[model samples]
Target: MTLELQGIGVSRGIAIGRAHILFHNQPDVREYLIPAFSIEQEVERLLDAIEQAKQQLKSIRNHIPANAPADVTSFIDTHILMLNDSSLTKVPVDMIRQRRCNAEWALQLQRDALINVFNEMDDPYLRTRRDDVDHVVNRIHRILADQEVADHEIADGRLKGHIIIAEDLTPADTVLMQHQGIAAFVTEHGGATSHTTILARSLGIPAIVGVESVRRYVQDNEPLIIDGEAGIMIAGADESTLKEYQQRRIAFDEHISSLSRYKSQPTRTRDGKTITLLANAELPEDITTISNAGAQGIGLYRTEFLYMNRLAPPEEEEQLAAYRDVVEGMNNQPVTIRTFDLGADKTVDGGRHLTQTVVTNPALGLRAIRLCLTQPAMFRTQLRAILRASAYGKIKIMFPMISTMHELLQARNLLEQCKLELDKEGMEYDRQVEIGAMIEIPASAVCAEMFARHVDFLSIGTNDLIQYTLAIDRIDDTVNYLYDPLHPAVLRLIHMTLEAGRKFNVPVSMCGEMAGDPRYTRLLLAMGLEHFSMHPNALLEIKQIINETDLSLLPANTLSIMEVSDALEADMLLEQINAPIIIKICLSFGFLIRTDKRILII
Candidate 1:
């Protein structure tokens, strides 16, 4: 009998191969009283393990294929940096000595403390970072316990065509397995935003995550098929099932290949409505993919990376250089740089600038514009750097998480102040740089028209908009099911923002995950989203959907979806909106005929 399981598909593709169960289970750790003489010895053990873990990571980083995405190497670098941090290295050693405990137990204690801090973080992205701590600590525990590290090389090439089933995979493991030519992988744990998932998408590997207890249903070397788009894994399939999937796999590959034809083509709907497709970039290295994907320009260049994993926020010159690289790299393609969206809890200067008071919910507390306003000095530094970089290329400034008119005005005032400072210093910059605001908060969306009157453009950040509107943490598996982009309220907010843009004659764009998702491309287009910015990998596919869409037919259907209160009804309407033109026409005829019959009967 065939067995099937469902999971969240982070990447899009299909794979059929034999199962390769790769376990990276945490070693059971036990605390033991250490003799006074052995206290120093116990600390040395932890230091040695840390050194080994760092070496292993360095080796893996060195062996990473030159063709791999820059993010792959960056992930490894992060792990190595974590190992070097005093919290992981010196703090654990101190605990081992102070408590007179085994090295593994001390590390475990420190890991729990670190994870508690991350768990209390309200931002989903920051909360998920605790996984990195687990990954790094697990490696050290395994080493101190004399167990083999999980990221060991598969020298015999036996996993070349197999599907890996694991409890969870670290970024290093994903990168290594992909290098060995693994067909795909599925994990029993992970969310869509995990580093492993991000790496899977970047590596172009078909993967499914959050499949609970996947190992219980499958045996080693069992033939398996995984549909990454549908988030399904099938084992012990009948011949007919295998044959069907084989054909589907072929078609999927062909369709992906066909998307390349649209790389240079204009993004226009069937009715000749032109759309602007842009790429969201994190690092400067993303420029190559963004350009090759034929993005009109960088829609969202996130500046948070400059503040992350550092002791202090980047200096003006340092930030200018980094921003200049991307600005010049785009070769005059417009780049929209969003200011640092960091929270007070996520201080870049090692808690030197963080509030002493406990923030129960960092997401709702001081963050983004609020945090920037409180720290005017830091905000001005970034604004000055952005202004300086504008002289090098087409640059636009964007402020994140603006919830009220007051916040918007205050941010704009800071920008003006930065401009004046630069002028006094005789700095050459783009005085006409376009300024924009992000509509991610419900309040901001509701008051979008007021904001549109101020900014040059508006970008709907649906990721946070949906989360905040629904009052659920999307990264939380328990309530994440309630996180729906098609909810009546979410659509209404989006429509309000779009309508506001139209009323003020200002351009509106979407830079959230919704923009990259092809499933919502037509609905968004019908709702008047002419500008979309997403990951570079998703540009071509979204462009394909846009080219095939007929805007003339979508407005009525989209409006129907917007009017429906029930989510199910809205979903039904969305499907109709995305249906093929022929199918849609037939449905329209059928609806009209049914209405005529009802009228005659009445």
Candidate 2:
């Protein structure tokens, strides 16, 4: 009997192999009163465990293959830095001494506290960071419990052709398994944005996460098939099914290999329309990947990472250096640096200490432009740093979450103030540095024309726009189903923003997951989005889709989709828009076609 299970696919590909179950049960930790005399000894035990965890991560970092993505090393570096943070090290020791509790219990308590902070973060990407904290804390907990904290290694290439089934995976474990030549991995727990999942994508491995009780039915050594694109796992497959999947695997591999040709090719549509494809960057390490992907420029460079995991905000000089590195790395390519988008409840000392309030709904509470306005001093420091870096490269400043003209003006006013201060100090900077506004909120999307009048460009951030327009938490598993980018309301808002940009003669770009996704690439082009920015890994694939698209054939079909109220009907129309040239010609010629369960005649 063939059995199937569904999960969240984070990385795309196909894998067929026997199962390799890796059971990593977390050790139980209980609190008990400790004698005052042993308090120091208990604290010392925790310090030692913390030190061991750091060394282990360092060792893993050292062992990462040289051919691996640069971000791979950065992920391990994040874990090591978390281990060294005072919240994990000094805070736990203080808890042990103050509460006279066991080291394990103290560490567990601190872990819970840290996770709670992460859970309250408004950004889905930031919220998933709690998984990193959990991975780090669990390492120390295992060490304190005298258990093996390292992943068990098989010396004879036993795992080379095996599919790893696990409760979850840390970035380190994922790296080690990839090095050992695992075929793919499926986890019972993890989100799409977790560091482990991101690493899997970067390493070009087939991976699915958030499958429930996957190990319960998958026995060790059972033959299995994983479709990472569909988030499907199959067991007990017959010979015919195995043959079909083998053919699919070959075709998929060939398709991936063919994407490299688009790296140096121009992103022009079949009808001769040139599209500007850019890459969204986070850290300076991404510049190399962006360049290799042949991105025209950096469309969105998030600045929040500089303020994370630190007691104080980065001073002007440090930020200037980091921005300068990215600007220089791009070698004159335009870099749009978005101001920090931290929320009040975010786990950063600068944000929490300044806000000093427990926000019930951080999503709707103080964040992004609101937080920046509240902390003018911090905001000015960032503006000055950005201005200083503009002298080095083609830099643009973008403001995030600008819901109202008042907020936009307020932010722009501060930028003007920073410019005047730099001028007074005789600083060399770009006097005409372009400014843009991110249309992520419904209010901003509705009033985009007004924003366009004041800024050089408008970039739609569909991740937050869809979430806000649909009134759903994108990261909440229960409500996330309602988060739809294809929703009629969302499409209308996007269309309105694009129209507004056109009316003002301002360039419009999209910098969200939707921009990178191949499924909606044609639809977006028809809707008048000229610029697209996404992860560097997705650049080549998106460029390929753009090169094959014919803009002349899309507008009418896309307009029909926009007017449809039913999501299924819109999806069908979108499929027709993206169909192959033969199918499209048939549709245009009034041919009847049966696809799946639907029969349609044009």
Candidate 3:
């Protein structure tokens, strides 16, 4: 019997191979206990475990030669820093002493403190570092245990030559990914830049995610085909089906060879219009991927990730070093950094929520630009840091989730105050840094023209823009199906956003999931959108759409395209394309023939 699976495309490519299962399970605190003979023995146990962990990491870190690249060294340093950090080690050791609990129990108790911090941070970038902590804990767990047990070890004989599925995975688990390894990874949670995605991409594997019920659907050793590029799932395939893909698989390799030619070429449309191809990155490790993918700049540099893994906020000096690394790595290319957008949904030491107050709806709760305003001191610290880094490179600061004038005004005011303080210190700063607002909210979309006056440019975040505009929490399991970026309402706001931007003569760009999707790329380009920022993996496909786009007929296509009733029409329009397809066919031939136009996907 054949089976099919589907998932989001992270790094683009094609592969057809047998399943390679990677078992990733949470560390059982029960496993780390050592007989407590005395305080001396307990410390020795921990010290020994810590040492073993150091060696295992050093071995993995040294797998690549020393002269490989700076990024490789930094990746190893990340694990090293986490392993030696006092945040996880000190608190847990203190707990073991105070409570006289076993080391395993001590680890469990101390782990909560670290987990609490990660759960509270609203920044996705920072929130992602939770994986690093998990990595460290897992590393230590393996070191302290008597048996060399991990769910799946690549070097193990049983590990290679099978497809793997898990609830979730960490980077440490994925470190086992060797070249010509990791057939695929399917999990209940993750996006393109997820830990599993990174490992799979590095190993060039096909994967699917958010399958909703992957564990139930998949039987152990069930034959399956995971299509990474098309995001298709094909159950047992007939010989012809397999052969068709085989030819395409070979074509994919040839296609890859062709892309190398454009790796150094400027991204230009067939008409010779140039478009800046860039990457939306949060981690410093991501910067190299962007550069290697031949991206021109870093379009969205989410700063929250730096603060997520640790106990306290990063020091000013640490922040400076991070920014310098990113900017200097870009070699004068632009890096637009978005300030931290934290709220009740994302709590911190300085967070305004009543201590530990839990809110039901975090998306609508205080977050992004609003959180910064509530805590001006915290806000000023970030602003001051960005301005200080301005002298180092071409940095553009953008605020996320700005819904009203007051938020933008007060944020600007805080920025101005920081500028003065920097002035007094005789620090070199970008005297006039470009400021922008993410047009994610409905009110902001309609009022974008007014916003452009106060800001240098507008980058529409369609992911949240669609959600807030439609009053849908796309994350809500009940409404997840309603997350539509191609709905007419979404398009109009985009149209309005672009129109408003044009009126103000400010550059308008979209840095969202919608921008990266190939199907929507042409539709967006026809909607008068020129600037796009998306995942590093999406640049080539989106650019291909841009090159093949029939921009001439988009104005006429608008009426028919908008007439399609719903997302399915939009889906069909996207999935199929002719060499010189008319934009109008996409608009009219969609499945939205009968639905009401005003109803939103949410």
Candidate 4:
């Protein structure tokens, strides 16, 4: 009999292949007392395990295909950094010495302590980081128990052209499986915002996650079909069901092909309002996607990747070459490169040497502009490189996590110094390069007018803004339900920032996940935002939404909707305004019609 399953689809595509189940059961690490003298030996064993895990992560990272996206490297680097973190390294060693416990027991104790802190976190994104810690500890435990870690032998020509079914896959596990030509993956755990899912999306693989008991219901070599768009999985699928899905997949392909025609079309609403759609890039390979997606420019170029997965800070030449490639690749499109957003749990490339202290809560600790200001030499090198690259094309510099006027002034003063140094060296570069700040923290959002007066532009990074405003992590499943983008407070902050940008005559753009989603397109456009930057994959859908919208028709309803105090009511109001045939309004221009089944046509 054919059995169907439902899960949260994180990526879009389809595949039909034999199931290859990988067990991810937690290892049993029994607590047993060791002699005081053997404590030294146990500690050595633990350190060895940590070192071994780091080597494996590096090997996996190195194995990633050259054509793979930049974020894949970042995901692997994050795990490797965790292995090097004191909580995982020194804490377990101390536990072994102080508790006189075996290596496995001591590691588990430290893992629990770290996870407990994460569990108590108010943010959903940080709370899910507990899984990263869990995956690292499991790797070490496997080494301590002398067991073969899963995917250790994946390169031996085993897992090819199959659908991977697992309890859960770490980012490293996903990268390895991808290298082996795996068709798709189904996991029993993980939410849409998890790093694992993000990697899958970046790899363009079909994946479904959070399917409870999916591993138990399926077996190795079982024939299966995965519909990533519909979040449906079929085990031993019948011929009729397969045929139906096959046609749907063809239709999806056709729809994508149709979207390409609009690639060269201008992004204008029905009333002739033009919106600048930009791409958020982190890697050089991303420029191709951005150009293909017809983005007006690169709005947010995260520069942290240059400083990650290395032993030292990027030199001026190295940084210059990287930035120059992106600027040149985008042709004449403007590229706004954000400075290193490291610190917190995102430490990488021996950056701990720069900070020299472990941050208890990385979110509020030394990171972004704070870290840059604290390390002026390294910061100066980056500024010179960015300034040098600006001479090649339209390039802008952006600072992240600025919460006060003082910090922005301090950063601007440093920029002036870098410009002076460049002039002394007789280098020619763009002296009028635009500067921008990310409005993420509530204080910055509330004081957006102050920032607008000083900067050329302001970009809203709603990922952090919502997390900080609601005290909810977007990744934690426990409280993820409360992660509301439509919350009144979040909207108010956005409105204030937009109003300030208008009053000060500065461009305001949103470059977060919310910017990519089409659901909020009308609301944001009605709010007077003229620019949006998002992942390349979502650019087409948003463009479709923009073509059919009339900004004039939305002001009254959008204002009324924003005034609603309750989220549910506000949500209802938005739906009412977004309905396809509201008030039987006749249309002079093309309109998008979405049925109850959500099949869309424009």
Candidate 5:
């Protein structure tokens, strides 16, 4: 009998083939003391394992095709650097000698310590780096434990034309699979924003993630079919099922190809209303994709990365260099840089310990602008760097998580101090740099008019706004289902912020997951949102929707959607108003649209 499974479909497409399982079990290392006489031998053994892991990473980096994409090579090179870095290799060796423990045990301890530091971080992108540390050390663990290191690339003649199944895949694993001619891949864990899924989309591979226990449910070599568009997986598929997916696979491919044509078109609604679509970025590597996606600007350049994965916070020069690279790349497009939003769960490496003792709930504790206001020195450092970089091109500064007028005043005061210092130092920066505030907190959203008077623009961070307004933790899967963006309370907050921006004549934008999603495109536009910032992958698709949409047809529909009390009812109203537009899109692209579920599969 066929066993069907559901997961979050991240990369869209379809795949049908035999299963190729990649077993990557964490090393089980129990702490035990070795004889003093064996201590030197253990240290040497640890060093040898480190050398072997370095060699393995070097080989993987070498295997990256000469003609492969720049990102693939960049990911492999990063792993090789980690293997050779003193922090990883040298630190573990020191632990082995000092603790008088086995090599596996020593490395395991170091991994935990490093992960602990990363876990306390507030940036989601930096938090995910803990997985990278795990993958690199797992390579050494395999060598130390005398376990076979499975081949990652498919060129070694293991399972050709097979769908890879794993508990989770790192960026390196995804890149290697692309080179291996793997048909598709399924993972038990990951999200749409994960680097693994991003790589899969870049490589144009079908992938499903967050399917718990998929690896254990299927035997090796079992025939499997993956519908990435629908997030469905069928094990031991029947002939009829296989035939249905084959047709879908073709249509999905054609639809994706058609989207590329929008790369050069302006994003304007059918009623001739121009829309500004910008890219939300975390890393410097993401900037190229932003331009490739034809974004008008970088809406949100998350600066938390400048404070992560290091012994201390990035120096002003270091931050300036990174910001400059993005500025030069955008070629006059506006780049809004948010201040280092540390505290909460995200802690800085070399910066001040703002939260010494763990707060029972860090989310409500010192974070974002609150932490920055309390620690003006740290805030000044970032402000100076951002001001210095602004001279290079169009740059704007945005403060995150501002909950009160006092916090905003304190932050602006320090920013002025940074500008004075820069002027004293004879540095060149744009004196007219635009300042903006992120209206995420309910308190701030309610008082947006007060904020608009002080800043040049307002960008609604809907992700946090919805989470806070609905009293749900977005990261907590249990309560995540209750996180509604369409709820009446959430809509009122958004509407209030936008209306305030309009009253003050300040540009209002949204830089959140909701802004990137096509499902809410018409709803947001009707609510008077003209600026949207999202992941680069969705830029073209959202633009396609914007270009075909007539803003004149949406206000009444949006009013009706907001008045509904039931969440499901609101969703149905949105689909009813939006479905015709989607259908037109599907017909234009010559693809079938299946609305059997929340996801519109083409």
Candidate 6:
């Protein structure tokens, strides 16, 4: 009997191949119990592992197709860097010596520390890199602990006459499979935003993650057809289904190819409304993604990176150089630069100590503009750098956390201080630079009208607002279930903020994960959201959604759902509406989706 499995649909495409397990996670040695001179020995071992990982990464790089996309190269290059970084190897090796533990044990400790860092990042792109970091270190730890290099890739490459099934895949491992012609990939863990999913999408391969116990169903060499797009898999000898799927696959490929032609064009709806799309980036290198996507601007340029992955704060000049490059890249496009949003969980190296002995929650802890307001020097320097760079192109400064009127005033004061200092020193600055505040805090959301009066614009940071309002840490896997985007509290806050922005005649944009979900596009538009900022990759797709949507009825549809007492019902209502037609239907009637799950006519 074939044991069918289910998993989250990540990448789209079709494939059929054999079961091949990439390398198992490296052994997890908690620590070493050795005699004297143990630290020195562990250091040497780490060095050896570094060299080995380098050689392995080099081999992988060499095998990648010359025509392989730039992102593919980045994945390999980043893995190599992770393998070589002293932070991962050196510090852990030192810890092993200090604690009299083995290299595996030391690595385990370091892995814990690295995870702690990933947990601190507020930026999504930067936060996602943590997953990459975890995967890399986990692999290294397992490899060293297990003392094995399974020739899985080599064996499977030759045995291409089979299907691919596994528990889950790291982005790097998935890329490795691609080089081997593994055909299709299925894993038990991953999401729509995972790196593996993104790679598969970019590479035009079929992949499914979160499918459970797939190995129990398929024999190692069974012929299969994986419907990655629709999230289905067929095992062996279904000639009719196979033929039908093949035709569907062919059509899908043709359609995607057709869409590729619009890769460089502005996304306009079939009805002729031009939409603005911007990319979310971390490093300067990501600017290429913006150019490739033809984004209207850099929707979110995370500045936390300038603070994270290092022992000291980035100097003003260093920041200026980085900011100027992005400015130059976008040329005329606007870049919304949010301030460094550090919370109690994210401590600056030797800069600040926790004032509160123990805060129940750090996510709602002193973070973002709150942290900056508390640490004026860092805040001032960042402001100066941004103002200096603003002279290069269209740039707007946005503060991340502004709950009280004082925070906004303090932030503006800092901005002014930076400008005054720059002026006194004869440094070029954008004197009339516009400023905005992220309405992430409940206090700010409730008083958005007051906030609107103080800033040029408002951007709802749904990621934080949802977490704060529901008191759920979205990052904590254990309690993430409690985080609900459809919570009445969340809807009320968003609506109130958007309403405030509209009333004050200031633009309101959403720069949160919710903005990226197509399912919520109609709901958000219906909420009276005039602007949407999301990951640049979604610009065209979102534009497609926007073009097809009639803004007039979305509010009513949203209100209609809001009238419902059950969150499930609201979600079900949203799911029932198709993406392309939801807008047309809304515009046909002046309806809005409300917080109470009931329709309200405009």
Off by over 4 Å in 1: 351-353, 581-602
Ranking by TM-score: 2, 1, 5, 3, 6, 4
**Roughly what TM-score does model 6 have, to 2 decimal places?**
0.83
How far out, in Å, is residue 386 in model 1? 1.1
Q: Could you tell me which 10 consecutive residues in candidate 5 have the lowest summed lDDT?
A: 345-354
Candidate 6 C-alpha lDDT tens digits along 134-227: 6776666655654566555463556353446776566666667677666778776555556777778767677876666677777666667776
Error of 2 at 135 (Å): 0.4
What local distance difference test score does each model get?
A: 0.86, 0.88, 0.68, 0.82, 0.81, 0.70
Candidate number achieving the greatest TM-score relative to the actual structure: 2
Error of 3 at 221 (Å): 6.0
Q: Residue 398 CA error for candidate 1 (Å)?
A: 1.1
TM-scores of the models, in the order given: 0.94, 0.95, 0.84, 0.76, 0.92, 0.83
For the record, the alpha-carbon RMSD of candidate 1 to the native fold, in angstroms, is 5.1
The lDDT leader among the candidates is 2
Q: Candidate 6 lDDT (Cα, whole model)?
A: 0.70
Per-residue lDDT for 555 in model 1? 47
Root-mean-square deviation per candidate: 5.1, 3.4, 5.8, 5.8, 2.7, 5.8
**Candidate 2 local lDDT, 395-483, one digit each (tens):** 99999999999999999999999999999999989999999999999999999999999999999999999999999887676776687
Error of 1 at 403 (Å): 0.8
Ten-residue region with minimum lDDT total, candidate 1:
593-602
What is the C-alpha lDDT profile of model 5 across 1-602, one tens digit per residue? 88999887778778888998988866687888878899889888877887887786676677777655456666666677667766676777788778888888888888898778666654454566677778788878888888776676435756557899999897777776777788899998776656677678777788998888988898889999988867888997788777767766776677678889999998899999998999998778777778888999999999876775456777888999999999999999999999987775564553235467766666688888888887777778789989999999999999999888888888888888998999999999999999899999899999999999999999999888887888876544456568788898888899899999999899999998899877888888888899999988889989888998998776465766667889878878878778868778766666556553554655
Clashes of each: 0, 0, 28, 6, 6, 52
Model 2: lowest-lDDT 10 consecutive positions: 588-597
